[model samples]
Target: MTQTTQTDRTTTGAIPVPARTGVHELDPAEAQSAREVALRLVATAGAVVDDEKWISAAAAAWQELPLSLRHAVRAFRRHSGSRGTLLLRGLPVAVDELPATPGHGSSVQRRATVPAALIMAVASGLGDPIAFAPEKSGAMVQDVVPVAGREEFQGNAGSVRLSYHNENAFHPHRPDYVLLICLRPDHDRIAGTSTACVREVLPLLSPAGREALHAAEFTTAAPPSFGAGGERAGAHAVLTGPASDPDLRVDLAATRPLTARAERALSELADVFETVGRTEVLTTGDLVIVDNRVAVHGRSRFTPRYDGSDRWLQRTFVAADLRRSRSHRADDGHVLI
Candidate 1:
């Protein structure tokens, strides 16, 4: 892993991509082991996906296990967690064959790939998982990669200039983890996903700045992408919750700090974001899990080629538990109907 430190203003906004070493790469055995564990956890999550009652029962049974098992269970979850992002190359890909159109209505569908079961399994391995899709949550993991019928590259969505961000940063229901499972790469394969650890940047701020970060000196709002159009919102406190286990609230475009100290901490936060964020390209069968609380994630720009096989990735949101967003979901672990 590469260590990160703050530099003068001249170096801000640039996160260097480090050369890969042997340890960060996963081999077949480790990949398979991860898959099997995810399968077990998903089967154990008590979810009614695909009308499979046994899987639901399986998930429930695992939940009954000893508490000590949780940590070990996550071993099968994310291997390198200090950075809060783990990369695995081989989990089963649901749509092994090409689809009639990227948006076909089957397991072989193109734009949206990856089995929902696997996502649930990974969530159980983490803590709690749920869908933001309305059909599942009211929001589909909306294909930003491939538009199914069209061959355009949809890596992150829209024409907006995307920067590092904590997804759903303001909402009380933000997921603790964001998993991106890749099925196809853009024609060029040059696009890279970027991420940075808050731990790395926390030390860059002045003592007073750090204090402001700990208090309710700031406010953030939903980005324009989530229908926040024409109107803007604000957030108080750059963060809330425990220091050890915290929930971050920030928006690069919308975040506002009340004092100079709070402003400095926010600046330090952005500096750390660009300094430490390591960009990793996603290839076929590559699955990356991001710790939403500890790190912010986004991607670099890639032009789409409107061909049949554009970049395709399956995205799923896991909250770690439904209680975190009780105002948005109903019981039985399903989103509000």
Candidate 2:
């Protein structure tokens, strides 16, 4: 897909905000095959989503997927392009039998469903699923829906324009990939999930702006959902690792520049994101995988009725290697303590 960027710094942001209109969809046969595997795993797991054997079985099934599909998933896992996002449409999500969108969060029953199993199957292709103990009862898959009282809040439950952010940016064990599966879309179909890749925005940065972002002059506060309250993380660079294609870790809603120069640099970066970020309106059976290290994601504002038919999405955090967080987990489990 082609999109133009608005470069007028006075009127437009540094990056031109555009919507992603293209998708990488699976063929009908592939979708059916994936559904069969997912349903089999769901039946085997029964009502237990946290069982190690069940998860392992799901992973093993993922390995048996068609080589072509596996290769595509692996390529994205290794390196996403300037968009830093992969949209897979027509994955088998058993929506007809799905219960009403959970207004609160994921439950064991929901986790054992076919859609959840499909998510786990896809995640196995990328990495190990992980969750934080303080969030959503440490369930590996979290239900994203607009909560009744959190409409204006900048969080998963809010219907407002959520600021772009790396998943769990303040945590040392933050996820490497954020997998979101759409079970139900917003009524108006206008609620788009936005993503901005540092790869795309880096070219727009001035040398001074790039230098400032590479320095350790920014601090990010832990979102309230993490239960850290007002806790802030140590000083760190907004961009780090290799200079050619650095990693990104900034939460527009929670990050703060620690100096005057850093503040100006951050403002410039924000403009770049606004000018280039792309939004995608997810549909049922669509899974959007994001490289959390190379890009940030947020959601656009949309009205939610709070009725049973509101938008619904399931999210999971994944790491390329789970062993890195061994010390932060119990029995070296998926849940990060």
Candidate 3:
């Protein structure tokens, strides 16, 4: 673990850089316990992860995971510390046993694989897992692999430097937690998943910048992953809730400032994010959970060989309060329309 912090710009006054957190590494025994739990889930869930019965089974299996793992996740759900990110290393992912990374767009794991079971079980512990109808066919577990022709795109299929964004920022019922489990690293191991929390960034912003961000002067359009006819958020504040510890809601790629002051504020916010953000190069069996309400996440640029073994990470979204989006979900299911 390295300690890296950026100095605040002289023009913007002094910005305090928070201490970096260490990865929570599971011992061999704990890892094995998790593996058994996930394997049992695979047996019970059968071959369909999207089935409501599978989700119910996963929720039951969540209690069977290692007590340490469950405790960590429960504490994070209560308060996500200064970084608003939790990285757990040494889960139960069998890298060598996995099939070739999918190269197609909108890839999702509908089958009840080991990795899929592990993520879904954890998702149930944190909250109910949810997905957008327009994104990745509304599957709970989605593949975060690079697609052949979408190298320059901003979404999951791209290998470029993805700008920081709150996942599904334009949606009224956006996810509260975003979980990514790394099954394979890039060939060069340079693709870093970075996160910046508003807690760490608020001090770096100017008074005027903070005020402008709090005002309803921004609109966010749905990302390319949503395709055509996706809904957009209108006239929303980039920062909401208590000014002391406000929630962040801005997508660097999709949010647009409405006024001149708002534009300058957005730029300032971006600068602060770059200054205080932390990047982690994930390895196999590593899981990173970002508090979507407090932090925005993105990825660093990495070259994809397009071979069978490119970077492969599976993702799932969790909504802390599933009832809030009941109307958007059909038949009270998880997928939000």
> Whose lDDT is greatest here?
3
Write model 2 residue lDDT over 1-337, tens digit each, in one string: 1233333444564433233433468788988888777778878844477777777887887876555567667878777777888888888886788788778633323357777787787789999989888877888778899888878887898898999999989889999999999999999999999999999999999999999999999999888687646568899999999989999999998999999999999999999999999999999999999999999999999999978889999888898999999999999889988
The 10-residue segment with the lowest total lDDT in model 1: 104-113
Q: What 10-residue stretch in candidate 3 is worst by lDDT?
A: 1-10
Tens-digit lDDT string for candidate 3 (1-337) = 1222233345355533422453577899999999998888888835589999999999999999887777788878888988999998999898779999989887899989989998999999999999998899999999999999889999999999999999999999999999999999999999999999999999999999999999999999999999976678989999999999999999999999999999999999999999999999999999999999999999999999998899999999999999999999999999999
Q: Estimate each model's TM-score.
A: 0.69, 0.90, 0.93
Task: List runs of model 3 lying over 4 Å from the truth.
Answer: 1-22
**For candidate 2, what is the lDDT?**
0.84
What's the CA error at residue 261 for candidate 1, in Å? 4.3
The runs of at least 3 residues in candidate 2 whose Cα sits more than 4 Å from the true structure, single-residue gaps closed, are 1-23, 105-110, 228-230
CA lDDT of each prediction against the hidden true structure: 0.57, 0.84, 0.92
Candidate 3 structure lDDT: 0.92
